[model samples]
Target: MNRRTVVVGTLVVAGAVLAGGAYLYNANQAEQAVAIANENAAVLIRPNSPIIGPEDARVTIVEFLDPACEACRAFYPVVKSILEESPEDVRLVVRYAPFHDGSEEAVGILEAARAQGLYVPVMEAIFAAQPQWAAHGSPNMDLAWSAAEEVGLDVERARIDMRSPAMVALLNQDLADIEQLQIGQTPTFFINGQPLTEYNFERLDEQVHEALGN
Candidate 1:
């Protein structure tokens, strides 16, 4: 069986044998972990990172996401739902965590779509089509591109932009910070800089509400 069908390596699939218990195990042991040290807080958000929602939002969710990770795909709508309910109060800052095969290509498509102000639509499309392209052990990138195109992405333009130095550098920066922040998992979340203590929809929603003092 493909390891990523349930979970992808964050820290290897060995930890994933039991219904992604490793993620819960790690998150539960962090002693209510802060996502990053205050001194290193600046690393969490960079100007180049993709942002969704108002720039002046009161709460920021920094998510370390791998596009090819099934878990990330599963959580996308939940995150979106929270954002929709509180659009002006929360913003999502996406950080790259390309832990699966062909994820960079997927990220490249996303970054390029961002340039055209099509980030969310393209991303939704990509995630909707993820099963076709992100099938573990037998990935097919063409399906991803097709989905992006269906969302009105200018494929040719995206193709050129994906290889640009700026995109490459941005990706590299995100990866560097991932290591610096000790992020070892896909879909790892930090709300207002405090890492999520556990991987569950209820906890995730609670954290966001708590951040808003709701």
Candidate 2:
């Protein structure tokens, strides 16, 4: 290429890189602002929310999860591993963000399961059968119910409890947090009230360890 042409091309490439870098910086700043504003973990770790592991654990991992979300199902084991690895140091708090069709009903089912003292088993069962019941665009809710039944959840009683005022109130609070936190995706995680910028095992592990001061 000619010298002038090469110089022009280099300038264009340099400009693009600068612009991209600026965008990333701005985005990171905005995310940090949001994280700072929403650091009150108590708003999410309410009495009604599902808790896995020691309630008073030092490291709290809050997950905004949609039952029908494939990503949520995929992350279940990862979160489970974090708890299993350091049961006394880490705990998981789940907040429902059921954006997909029929996923709200699944959340209701989980609430009912909680009432029945079967939340953990039912949740595990649902995740295990997520593909069959949580199919994208055309979920098979019957299969979800069946999975709950297999885990000994009383479907009939659960239906009644799902419609209870208490369940409605809990769901409303979770929805409000979803909006206030500007959560646009399922399985959004926060470790010690700081949001996860990237979703990956290593990043999550790092955050967990950081929270534990390890």
Candidate 3:
């Protein structure tokens, strides 16, 4: 199997393994866990988060995503589809969960890309070439930089900005949120301060609809 695939499978699949325990605990605990999780989710959507779609949309999908996770790359289009389908009603707020090695660096590049007004384009480029740079323990930073460069990002400027105090602080804050929210994996999502309570595309779609009161 491909190393990158293995890496993503390891993290996400392991997370799935824990879901059984979560379910067992939830059965014994009633809605208490979800209530606490919803409270935690409320603290996740920072104003400075990278957002797509209408800022004042009725529904918000806050995703704690890691740049190097293949699952995150896969769900990118699904989230985009949700946005495209309901441009007026929904927005996506991306929170960094840079769990994998080099994932933080990737996020740094994305923050730099955001500064240069290339956030969406660079995100597209990175996910498009995710397997190339996001390999298991050995991320190819060169390819990641090249992806940003391909999108007209000023690479040298980005490199400098990546290490800036603002960017460093941004990463730190998101990481802190991850810990506080008890997020154990990447690509975790909350819709309108409501945890999905289940993991699947159908569940995501349902949650979004529920948030919209539809």
Candidate 4:
């Protein structure tokens, strides 16, 4: 081949090789990102946990939320839908980071529900009927108790457990986790381990695909 033709052929081959290398590097990065996320996101699951979703799921979603936060309440349905749709594949862990004074009481009640193995039911009931009790302007223990009763919890025991040091510690630990993760607001979500700034069904699907090498 003439020099020009040989040079052109070499340039084309080099370009293809470079493009292939770039693709491989990107693929490696996506894999590493997912791995890192999973490692940072693993959290303890309490027995009879109120948290929803599968324990061994491919995607874990951690949410820092406040019981009295209106925005958190608003996001309830969306979270519910995500859980229902991905029951076996998505694990959701809820960490209470009460932004209001009344948040502690609400958090206590939730912790109590965990003790009773009624955590999920109580949380679902509370979110479903949030408009009724959350409007009390503070973490109304009475209202939280009422919601517990509505969810078939042993209201008296729930109330008693809510006052325990263990419950307080649990809430404090949740708060610490939120802080450690640098969560600044209610409804802040971490998917796997990375904070999800633009999370939606589409993005979740895309991330899951990348994670699974699809």
Candidate 5:
């Protein structure tokens, strides 16, 4: 081939290689984006006590909640109703991430309940009676204790468990995980390994159907 023809061929080949490289780079970035999203969306399950839900559910809803947050309290019933209504269709994972002043104690209470295999019941009671305990002023250990007692948790054992080093470490680890995930608010949810911008029954229902391919 002539020199000009050879030069033209070389330029075309170089352009093709560059375009291929860019395409590969973009594809790799997309893959990484998905991986990061999935990681952020994953719940750090506590050891020993597993969350309750169907393993093969179409959607997994992971909630990072604060026991002392009023909004979380309000959202609790909504979530509970959804789970109750469609126990088989959706899996719910609850993670404690206390951000308020009394939140530490609340988390400790939850950990204590988990130790006694009464986490779900105690949590349900706490959320149900949130109006009675959660206040704007100071932490109310007495009210929390009352709620625990009402839920049939061994109050003495729960108090002792609340002071355990293991419980403290668990809360600390959860807080660290929350920070790592950059979670900024209570009641944050992840749907099918994707962080949701907003959470509502309608949205959750829609996402569940999408995930299930229904």
Candidate 6:
């Protein structure tokens, strides 16, 4: 065979090998997802996990998030867009990881707002003002509180509510699940029970679409 034919043959072989590898990896991941879905549903989907979207939606994206995580702040819009685009088909469930120094405080604030029926507004306000308060090295939760209050959260009541044992237990339960899953990242996502092994907008979109069969 000539050099061109030999080169083409080599490329084709390499392509097949890569494709096989990808297929095997996907199969393994799919099995793991199925196991998690069946055996770990109680841990993954507690009643108090914050949710946005329809309960009956076919696709559920569970996000293990830290309010102080810069990456989570960055990806917020990406996840929002996905939900907006697939309003009827996709749902989001947020579980706090609170990995940062002040993140547990932020989580408490969020739960307080939730108790007062201001969860979404307060969360958006806090997220919008994240940089002001979510200092990686030395966070000031006072700023986060101010942001929440600006969005109609009753600061005094929220403070009292945030200190409640119910809220503390809620955060602890989420942390327990995070530990059980061995999730080490702030914005880890699971789509339709499948852990997103790759983190990127395109990969996230692809996984959601694959689950939707779209």
Candidate 2 per-residue lDDT, tens place, 165-196, comes to 99999889999988877777777888877877
Root-mean-square deviation of candidate 5: 18.0
Cα error, candidate 5, residue 36 (Å): 5.5
Best by lDDT: 1
Could you give the candidate ranking by TM-score, starting with the highest?
1, 3, 2, 6, 5, 4
How high is the lDDT of residue 205 in model 4? 41
List the candidate 2 regions with Cα displacement exceeding 4 Å. 1-30, 33-42
| Candidate with the larger lDDT of 1 and 2 | 1
TM-score of each: 0.87, 0.83, 0.84, 0.69, 0.74, 0.81
What would the C-alpha RMSD of candidate 4 be, to one decimal place?
A: 15.4
Tens-digit lDDT string for candidate 6 (45-124): 88978889999999999999888877677667667777878899999999999989899889988999989898878888
Checking candidate 5 for backbone clashes, the offending pairs are none
Could you tell me which 10 consecutive residues in candidate 6 have the lowest summed lDDT? 16-25
- lDDT tens digits, residue span 57-171, model 1: 9999989998898878777766887788889999999999998899999999999999999999999998889989998877899999999999999999999999999999999
Backbone N/Cα/C clashes per model = 0, 0, 0, 3, 0, 0
Q: What 10-residue stretch in candidate 1 is worst by lDDT?
A: 2-11
Select the stronger candidate by lDDT from 1 and 6: 1
Clashes of 3: 0
Count backbone overlaps in model 6.
0
Residue pairs clashing, model 1: none
Error of 5 at 41 (Å): 5.0
Off by over 4 Å in 4: 1-50, 136-139, 199-214
lDDT of 4 by residue, 70-164 (tens): 55665555555556656777778887888876777777778878888888788877765666667645445576678877878887787798898
Q: What does candidate 6 score on TM?
A: 0.81
Give per-residue lDDT, candidate 3, residue 107: 98
